[model samples]
Target chain A: MHPLAPVTAVGRSTLSMLAAIGRVTIFLGATLTHLVRPPFYPREFLSALLSIGWFSLPVVGLTTLFTGGALALQIYAGGARFNAEAVVPQIVAIGMVRELGPVLTGLMVAGRVAASIAAEVGTMKVTEQIDALVTLSTNPMKYLTVPRVLAATLALPLLAAVGNVIGILGGYLVGTTRLDFNAAVYLTNTVDFLEAADVVSGLVKAAVFGFIVALMGCYHGMNSGRGAQGVGRATTNAVVSSSILILASNYLLTEVFFSA
Target chain B: MIAMQDVHKAFGPKKVLRGVTLDVARGESLVIIGGSGTGKSVTIKCILGLVTPDTGLITLDGQDVRRAERDAFLARFGMLFQGGALFDSLSVWQNVAFRLLRGALKRPRAEAREIAIEKLRRVGLTPDVADLFPAELSGGMQKRVGLARAIAAEPEIIFFDEPTTGLDPIMAGVINDLIREIVVEMGATAITITHDMSSVRAIADKVAMLHDGVIQWTGPVARMDTSGDPFVEQFIHGRAEGPIEAVR
Candidate 1:
């Protein structure tokens, strides 16, 4: 072994990490540029919208609903010690709309959409289909990345909004039935405390999470390693990276939106 | 009409192509043969701008390929990938007519499908296979579909990367003949990359041997057997020894 081998290896790894970041940044830039350009593929966009938006509704709905119900029960039980049991409706609404709704829905999509996109594009990479697209005079970024990122960006906000509503409904059902709270009072509390800013912030976070998910998926897929192992690794990385990014960005967005 | 001058490329510490220089005149079929991993695929990819050279000049009709308008530059070429590379989601006709249905070459949907069907027939596939997906076809049929897709737009140039790979010898012969027939019929500049000597004999007007990243020898196909270059002789005769390290 060389005398400076250890130092050189560390330096090399750090440089490669930085280089990876730069490539992903450039990939994102290209995707955004292609998003606004002409020669759009409406059919591809529609297909992506259906897959990322419509098909994901059931999972998002069920996840948020159960979360909201459990949150209401937990808040009720915890609030009882302080004689603050009636706070269930307000807390659940705020929790679901301000943070949990978008965050959980994002994680769910990160699992579903990101993995699928990565696998599809990664397999395309290994099979030379992406190269085929280039040979056919179609920009792969335009054909593959733009529609997905655009659809996810536009769709997540809608999904989060729906999830927010469903979550509140779940809280209402649990609070009124499991607890002794009056139905009208719970509804009024939920309705009164939620400002437009809270809802808008959640939707904004959802959009950002959407962008991260699709970008990570496409970036990994387009640059997948070589074979079956490479595609599998790409899919895993897409999900893991998107999930981490979603969580990290969620905290940052929360600080921006709600910090005193 | 395509020329690559002293092209060099390396993927990290491993050098793939080192100073590869060759030219394919208009309406010529140039087949490049070499051992596996000798950068045969990379050479063609460099010309098509799929893989940028680390240092080199690639020109088409004397215009630098890198500086050319991407869409217009690529529109003049078609490629048949080694594995066919047909879209899994697309029906056979859709795969064939992909270029016609999109971008600068957009056509009416009905007209595009008609052309796709016509090309499919030219490649020896029946109209009944039009609606099938790529996964439904045999390897030979997939190659035919790939060939049809390659020629669907009547491109001015075509690249075939291992067209005879993964097929029975009989099927390989059929594809070789079809490729030769199509090149002549379209009057297109052509380049084929493969290690199969049979494919070389059937498809090449001229042959270039790539070894250790550079063109070791190039001449008319007729002169290939008597060229007397050790590398070409070893490769053409499929000898395991002489110069090239089989393990490398």
Candidate 2:
């Protein structure tokens, strides 16, 4: 009703958003602090590693396989613009290692792992299992968040590396069988084109993305509102935010790694 | 002893606890009763430090709860939540043995399992229930397991929040009986929050009636009916017409 109502609404929304960022930053800082502190849960860490890494393999592997095959085809076709079609092996290898492999693996794991963590922890929060943990003299951050974040951070790089190999193999398979290229020559060109920097950068991106994914999931979950709808919203926010942060961090990391 | 003085807590514009004061001496069983959303649970949470008061003093054994070392302080108390709050991922024995398996109360796996089975038996659950996950248990069984967990570490103080919520009356009676027996046998200080009158009669040595974010009346259980406080009278009698206005 007031003339200044529109401005007030915008200001309120902006303030709320900033508050959310501040809270998430605090959650992240606490998680990192607890990660190094001891009375660590080796059982919880091993279990989380199994869930986030080993369980994620099939989905990450499948996504990269299909993506690598398609990337090889697209590169071959695009190269034909200048009759440079034979560059498929080189381009496919570079593209998969430098960008697509890590990004896709990150996003896939984000969707699968982040959503589960949020739903799981959100349920725990609302149902008072988290409070129960507190009453039992255990820090939920140390017990729940640290193990999960550490597992994801450590596992994603390994997952990405495996994804890189599988993806390159996919490209190799497609180039040789579907595109009628010499298998040995394609392998040599693929091997020759990808530098160590490319692989390292992608793995590093995978690690950061992994951290963002679990952090968002834990952050949203521990702060979730009371019931089923609250947990559902936390899960959605975890997946969406993690996916977006993954892409954003990927670009930023790439720039930092490759830019002069 | 646990003591609270003029405890006040608010969430946004909704003031849940205006000014609450209560006390439970060591080895006493105190039951808090109020309608839903009347801050009955908040009062218990304040004592446990699960929820901090906006303003007031809460002390346990003469130590300021806010200043107590968290692990050492928490080690003295255990709680049973309304929903059982069992970790779905953990089997029943593991849930019961949660405190024993980690942190300051760490025990070897075999010893913890033995303690878990013993506690579960104390709560009238079979040893067979130990290996099964919480999801496989019914609401009553889950409550029993939650009770088992609360006593696993044999804490000096125990709290039961809406301990009979969502269970059948027969199961509720069993839980109430178990609570009374456990409190008496362990000689642990007990605090319970509930609107259920049956729970009050079964569990309270002293009863406190909460209304409008404050303790309206508190007295020994024998004097509850004769206390003549309108809020207590209306709440205990389930009266619709009284000084205590029922929300439509």
- The lDDT of model 2 is 0.93
> Cα lDDT for residue B237, model 1?
89
> What is the per-residue lDDT of model 2 for residues B48-109, given as tens digits with 9 covering 90 to 100?
78898999999988889999988888899989999999999999999999999987789999
Off by over 4 Å in 2: A1-3
Model 2 DockQ (Cα-based): 0.92
Q: What is the lDDT of residue B118 in candidate 2?
A: 98
Best by lDDT: 1
The residue-by-residue lDDT of candidate 2 on A1-260, one tens digit each, is 99999999999999999998899889888998998889899999999999999999999999999888998899888898999999998988888888988999999999999999999999999999999998888889999999999999999999999898889888888899999999999999989888999999999999998899889889889988888999999999999999999999988998899999
DockQ of all models, two decimals each: 0.89, 0.92
Write model 1 residue lDDT over A1-260, tens digit each, in one string: 99999999999999998998899989988888888888899999999999999999999999999999999999999999999998999999999998999999999999999999999999999999999999998989999999999999999999999999999999989999999789999999999998999999999999999999999999999989999999999999999999999999999999999899
Q: How high is the TM-score of chain A in model 1? A: 0.95
Cα interface RMSD of each candidate: 0.6, 0.7
The TM-score that candidate 1 achieves is 0.96
* Residue B16 of model 2, lDDT score: 95
